[model samples]
Target: MKRLIGAGLAVVLVPVLLLSMLVAVLFGSEDEAQAAPPGGQPGVVCTTAPASGSGGSAGSTTGQDVAGFSGDQLDNAAVIVGQGKALGVPERGWVVAVATAMQESTLRTLNYGDTMANGQMSSSRGLFQQLDAWGPLADRLDPAKSAAMFYTGGQAGQPGLLDIPGWEQLPVTVAAQRVQQSETPDAYAKWEQPANQVVGAVEGRTCTTTPAAGAAGGTSISLPSNPRAETVINRALSQLGVTYSWGGGDANGPTLGIHDGGVADAHGDYAKVGFDCSGLALYAYAGIGVAVPHQTQAIWAAFPHLTDRTTLQPGDLLLYSSNGAANGIHHVGIYLGDDRMVEAPQSGDVVKISSGIWGGNRGAEFIGAVRPGA
Candidate 1:
């Protein structure tokens, strides 16, 4: 019999776009989830991994045949799901975790760091983008090893994350920081609730935060006033066919468009309207007051841990590999179910919705979707 991993979850709202453009957009140079390694005090290390194979899992039931996600995304999802099951994390948590990853490093373990210099890039190390400056490599490339480090800090003092303040009711960012010690703790707080909501819907499960037994109480991370509003998405849609620019969106930076898609002239700051990969992501979410980081790598750093891609939903990000590196996913977009996505296409292409995989373009590729406000 197929085991019901974590908790059975429900499906979330999925989007449907007509033309989708997913090229190298919003690509950032940084390592996300930089945390202290394990070997500290021992906590509740749930030895049993959660059971991922559901009897009849819902949502994107098409399995590997789904046209949206690429082979890499599917493979990554399978691995992540297996990992979540091994850890016995609720299915909802697993899905939300993947969404968090989507918002972060696009699920590609990083081998470099942010900040390019003198026409040279730094060769940092590890999964979830760890910097070598922190220390030498100690099982850095291994996702499990990195995950262990992340959990060591993220799950410190709390069994099943019960000790973290507002974790259960917060966004993926908040819940993530509870486990992952980050420079910007507040940043992760915002993604907590959305991540949970997305995970719950994808896994067909329900998570609660009423407190277990004698657990202390904390304030829930309040969600945006209207999560379902199409203001941001709509604005992004309106600004299709924009050119790409690098370093367009940083935290509290200019407001033209910093991500990949959309159309804009090149100039200093917000003089014109252009965006790179991360720029577009920030612009779209900013329409709704989300205030996402300008750097794509920072997005990964400031959120909960993510798992597989089968748990993706609309408004979620779909990051894919531009170059065929083992785990090098360089492109990103907003997921619109049925293998469709809404994003700013590459040069010569307008902002439009298209197939997640084949948006009628030779270079168009589909990776995995990241649920930001899941």
Candidate 2:
């Protein structure tokens, strides 16, 4: 929910060329009977490891297909929902929590710190992207603990889900907003439909539903389906833990960092060896004999897009905007599957795996993903 805010912040809104993508089997038939939530009935650690069914659960960890999420992604949601249930955050809070997670980290566990638009490093992390003031990094990253923190309160005793005044009366998005107070007040609304779909999925039930009329979608993306995607992802992952030196990478390897004269200079990135966001991407695709440039937008424009952006696969590049504007694509990352990505997040940071999605900052939404190369 937080990220670097550099200067030169000119933003232009574009039509939200949003794409709604979900695996249909993840949301069963309308007649499918409702089953209890994961954990076999809403207890602590209500997590499930996916059954080794051959046909395709899309790496689902809950043993059942869940829309837009699988593996640890779905597990994170179960933790959120189950924790909310344990705390008795009202059934509404469960949906609100799921929706909120959808808004914050796309139900993935984010480990990277973000810098705000004002160019300040924000130590926000975890499923909900709680700030450093929330708790320790470990606590923030723990699904159950983070969910508990969201339900219980922040370190400053800020209200959690149940503490909000008249929270139950609020609509799903409204209830989520009360807890999040995000800059994008209405962003959570888009996920409301999917959130219910997720809760129903976890509970072993689903309802007949229709898309909310006028529902805006986020930028769509796809992970690598390219035959050489493995080479790209492995190349990127190989550089994990390298410092995020601005302008400091190439198709060959890490190079002397360059100074951006701002945050990059402040971080002494010029003296370091590493890769910036686009540089890392450039280096990654190079492993596949792709010579994309080191600029995020340039790389974005270098390749033709895949026909579909529905399923996020490993090695797809996720884009970000400082102001949530579609035209403000400022950053990029290599998707690493299971709602995780490897990125060189900011000047003082390191290239590492983060909970794969950005909720946008200063008002924009995460441009979803469409794989750039065929």
Best by lDDT: 2
- TM accuracy, model 2: 0.41
- Judged by TM-score, which candidate is best? 2
Number of clashes recorded per candidate: 73, 14
Query: Model 2, 1-374: lDDT tens per residue?
Result: 45222221222211121122211111112211111111111111112442233122222345444555566667777677778778876555677787777767777787765666788666888888888888889999998998998887888776787787645434344455656656554455456556655665565444222211111111122233333654565456545445578998887666668868798898899876668999988888786676777887675566654323345555677776656455677888776544456688888776765652533351144555545454
Over 4 Å off, model 1: 1-68, 116-124, 132-138, 154-166, 177-374
lDDT of 1 at 19: 24
TM-score of 1: 0.33
Error (Å) of candidate 1 at residue 315 is 24
**Estimated TM-score for each candidate:** 0.33, 0.41
